[model samples]
Target: MLIRRAKQEDYCVFAAIEADCPGYPSWGANGFAAEETNRNSVTLAAEFEGAVAGFVNFWILRPQVQLNSLAVRGDMRRRGTAAALLGKTLEYARKNACTAVDLEVSELNSPAIAFYLKQGFEVVGKRPKFYNNTETALLMRKTL
Candidate 1:
């Protein structure tokens, strides 16, 4: 898989991937278009055989990078595409001088929580009823 910064033209593919991935927060095309223009945002794509297989969106805040969203095509899960996208995002954050990476995962998404833990993220806190009114969110962080 090839990982690289996403271009504005790739938003359609990015939006499609997010739509297909389970546990993704819903966002419209215009939302992604707006994100593409943010100076502090770093959106990345994982390409396989010339197609986008996954993507990660992050924001560079002072001293830290906030992992806004990470999604892999449903057909592409379990193939390390998400991991590659995440690794590239972390690399980008480090290059941009971020000292840490942070994200919130839905409490019900055990697989994703495990993936984050295996990638060196630790649970830092929790947000009560953070998703859809009933599901809580686990706040995870990793120091780069």
Candidate 2:
């Protein structure tokens, strides 16, 4: 799997990946298009066999990185696509002198929680009803 910067043409596939994981918040094609104007935003796409397989978006806020969104195609899970994307994020963090990576995951998403834990993230807090004011959000952080 190859992880690289996302292009405008890849937004649709990114959106589809978001859809493949239900209950995950989505930034549709238009939303991703708007990210082009954010100087701090970094969006990455994972490619497998020449096809887009997943995506991750984050912001490099000096001293830290805020992981905003991440998703892998349902058929591509456990193939290291998500891990590669995250590895790139950590590379960016180290390059930028960031000290930590932060993100929030839906409390009900067990797979994601496990993934984050396995990736060295610790639950630092929680925001009740953070997801559509319905599901709780587990705030996790990895101190780099």
Candidate 3:
């Protein structure tokens, strides 16, 4: 897998990957396109065999990088695609001078929570009803 910063041309592929990943908070194509040009954001893509397979979008605050979304294609799960994307995002954050990285995972998404935990993220807090209806969010953070 090849990980690199995403360009505006990859928005369609990014949207499609996010659309197929069930647990993610969906965003419109235009929103992703806008992220590509955001000064404080980093959008990354994982390509395999010349096709986009996964992506991670993050926002760089002065002292922290907030991961906005991460998704791997349905057929590409369990193959290290997500991990590569995340690793690249963290590297980008570090290179850009971020002191920490944070993200919110839905409480009900056990798999994702486990993945985040294994990736060294610790739950720092919780937000009630942060997702749709009664779904809660686990605020996880990793000090860089």
- For all predicted structures, in order, the TM-scores are 0.93, 0.98, 0.94
Ranking by TM-score: 2, 3, 1
lDDT of 1 by residue, 15-124 (tens): 88777766668665677779867899878888999988888888999689999888888888899998898888888888888899999999898889989999999999
Model 1 lDDT at residue 122 = 98
Flag clash pairs in model 2: none
Q: What is the per-residue lDDT of model 2 for residues 45-129, given as tens digits with 9 covering 90 to 100?
A: 9999999999999999989899999999888899788889999999999999999999999999999999999999999999998
RMSD from true fold, candidate 3:
1.3
lDDT of 3: 0.87
Order of candidates by lDDT, top first? 2, 3, 1
Q: Candidate 3: misplaced stretches above 4 Å?
A: none
Query: Which number leads on lDDT?
Result: 2
- lDDT by residue (41-71, candidate 3, tens digit) is 8788899999988888899896899999988
Worst 10 residues of 2 by lDDT: 15-24
**What are the runs in model 2 whose C-alpha is more than 4 Å off?**
none
Query: What residue runs in model 1 are displaced by over 4 Å at the alpha carbon?
Result: none
